[model samples]
Target: MWSLTMRASTSVAPPGAKTTMTLIWRLGNSWALRGAAPATSRATAAAIRRFIPIIPLPVDGVGRPSLRFIGRNAFQKGPSTVSETENVFRPATPRPAHEGNGMPQSGRTDGPKDPYLLASLHRGLEVLDCFGARNSWSLADLSTHLGESKATIFRVLHTLEQFGYLAKDAATGRYAPGLGLHALGAAAVRHEQLRWQALPPLQDLAESTGETVHVGILHDGVVVTVQIVDGTRAVRMHSAVGKRSPAHASALGKVLMAYLPDGEVDAVIAAQGMARFTERTLTTPGGLREALHRARLDGYAQDEEEIEAGLRCLAAPITDHSGRPTAALAISAPASRMDPARVAALVPQVKATALRISRMLGSPSMAAA
Candidate 1:
């Protein structure tokens, strides 16, 4: 329902004269006008004073961005605009619970280490986690799951919707997982297993080869080194775990990228743009695709100073029980020792070790391309 109220002070007025009017307006559950008044004539003033409408205020409320988005100089042309919205609406995208020290809702109740900050954000994530079991849920459903109120759930859902973690289906009035959820899920799943299993193999490789060895998994178009086993020898490569190396510059990365479905591999190369790392790194996707093809056929891949000036690496795909490569295991040493003959000597050993680890992990022969 809608209502309009006009209030004016009594004044001397002729029959045909105008007057000033003050209007208060409201819609269902919302107040649109507070106290807007217009100046007019004397007779009109009396008429306006008599024109008061005794009506009920609107009953429904309109949604608005919280104070998080408000600013005094909202449209200013100076530094005042810098404060802007400050990410309160979407709060910094939450890292997965598995990341850092953040606890999953299913786990601890001790809360974040920096408990004073991001507490509300942790609560919001708990709400998102509730959506994991069901495909879609309404505010009431979320409230029931999390023991929160409909209003609270709605606010969190609205904020999440704005942030792209959840999307509301206007037709059904339910919220479903958004693309960001899918991306995070994919990233989590892809890293969850391959990385853990690769650790033992990398350690063994470093022990056997007396050189630095690493296990890298492909993600977002790059081979991110998630595990590294440093060489025991004093004259060994110095690199850290979790460092991201280019697919083209890395023998293991190229082989891992190569094993992806052709179209998927092309999509990755297109997105990452095969820029050169070293003169020996494959600089073109077509060239890489060919290299991948050869790696698939040869059962091993090599980087001959492709990543760094004095480094060479021999890599073999770690096959699943299905015999398809899920990841690549590589041994990296100085070019002085990992020359053509040395790589040739190590290739079979690398392949054999990778096969042993693959079998231990229960991967089928189908992992081979």
Candidate 2:
């Protein structure tokens, strides 16, 4: 229910002209009166104030105006120069939660009522949601999907492109998911409990072997390093956390690839070609298949200067509860420090650390194996 209050005042136009009366109307708590004239006669204004009536009206819809009071007593015997009018409606109150179909009672699903829900942001997320199986979207296609104007959709697309969440083609003007989104996905994958649980053991391994240790997971045919423990050696290998390397060239990558299904392995290899990083890097399909077979048989993989010259990496698979290789633990060192004999000695230690991590993940098959 809404209540209306009316105020009256008299103003003189000229010496010989008649008096003018101004009526100021205010609606409910949401609106206020503006441009009201000053009282000319206190007694007459008081009399007018006494007869002012507060009318109650029903609020039917959002931003809907109430009925105007047009009764006989709405105007009094006065002059005709009631100039200047200002009527501004306040923002309407949201209806009760139960009144709308599946509308949240709190005006928000996640938190308390927030009047300033940015529509542009909501629409931008909706635009991102349109890029699932299709992979790319044009302005017209996004506008059609979202039922928004082309101008609005263009602005949203440009903003997303600027932030690197979406990439736009210069010639085609189509947009796809960008590298920034993949970075965010990689960060999320690292945030899993396994990374934290493996930190202590990885650190211990690095200290024991005096070589850099890494924990990485497969993402989009690449191995993304989630955790890194630098070795105590002065000339140790240095790799950033979130660094990505080819699955066929790095030991961590090969171990992870070896455990995936045959079809998935073929797809990953197809998507990420076997680019030869070094002379020792496997470039042919048959060579990579043989290496993966050896990794599966030995429960570990080796990178003999495959990714980078003068560097070697040995990796063992860390399995999940389903015995799936969700991550790999690797130790990296200079070729001079990790010679064939040293690698052979450290292989058992790397496998033991990996098995401990798999056990921590509650892998029944790993426990049996």
Candidate 3:
């Protein structure tokens, strides 16, 4: 599974500068060979070329600043060398999907070991994985968690921080997911089918109800806003996509969680604790259990200022082909305008539009549910 190719280039050595051999090693979809031997002697250059095993390779590929690390570390210049660096293998810009949507997204090193896998890359990815379970990680926390030496973890974290995949605080030195990761996540979400199918209907719902609409999906036990449509009303929920919110505090989260089996529901609850956001927010498992049961039975979920004092939300599940709820369609409005009577009127509309979106997703069981 491994191959070696080598090439060299020639450049003029200035006065008192030692003759140098510039060698470039590239991997992935494209490769290059740049540098030259001392042009002082053609015979010497020919001798070097004969000894070198690498030749110029044909190039064909686009490139970007990929963060995956491979090759040798920076070395100090020796007596005979003016300046030199070891091989740096730069892969193609568009990384393969299995590596994780251009972020090379996964960092689990626990699986079956691959000899070719870079331990540093694996460790860095694992660091990224910790962020999903929680927001920030300190170097000590990661070092203890990974059972890696402090020096190794420090190097891994430093490398990732330099690449923009992880951000480190100046005073605290606590690390968090950076903008680079968010950008990659956005790129991946833009290609997801669920958001694509739900967009039109969600827009329509926002227009009809004159309320802000959100399409939320369950991620790591919390509700994440995937798509948002602004309402026509001047006073509306000013929301952004990709926001993570508590499951017990929002109708969107409750509706999405209702369809899960008890075991998975427990997992979600375990991962995302029931933190009370407002007086009405469900803090006890028993109360949230009841709410989820009500959601499954009624085909919808409601948040009566549970998450925010003046905002109310109603949500219905959007099922996939297997009839499992893959996402939730929800609308948020000011509580003053969403009285019991208006809620009753809006319930049918919310459920119907969610059903429509589910149908578009090839949900065979929406009618039966």
lDDT per residue as tens, model 2, 1-369: 334443322332333232222333333322222223454698876765565432223222221222233333432322222221112122234433333443212222222235797766766776776775469988887666555689998998889899999999999989999987888886565457787889989988988888999999999999999889999999989998899999999999899989888899899889999898899999988998899999999999999999999999999999887778889999999999888899899999999999998898878888897
Local distance difference test values of all predictions, in order:
0.66, 0.74, 0.74
Error of 3 at 359 (Å): 0.7
User: Which is the better candidate, 1 or 2, if ranked by lDDT?
Assistant: 2
lDDT of 3 at 50: 62
* Residues 111-186, model 1: lDDT tens digits: 3256376767877877777676678987876665565578887888999899889999989899999988998897
Ranking by lDDT: 2, 3, 1
lDDT of 3 by residue, 110-189 (tens): 33346898876777787778889778888887776666678998998888888888899999989988888998996465
Model 2 segments beyond 4 Å from truth?
A: 1-191
Lowest-scoring 10 consecutive residues by lDDT in candidate 2?
82-91
Q: Could you tell me the lDDT of residue 297 within candidate 3?
A: 99
Give the TM-score (vs. native) of candidate 3.
0.52
Between prediction 1 and prediction 3, which has the larger TM-score?
Answer: 1
| 297 Cα displacement, candidate 1 (Å) | 0.8
Compare candidates 1 and 2 on TM-score and give the better one. 1
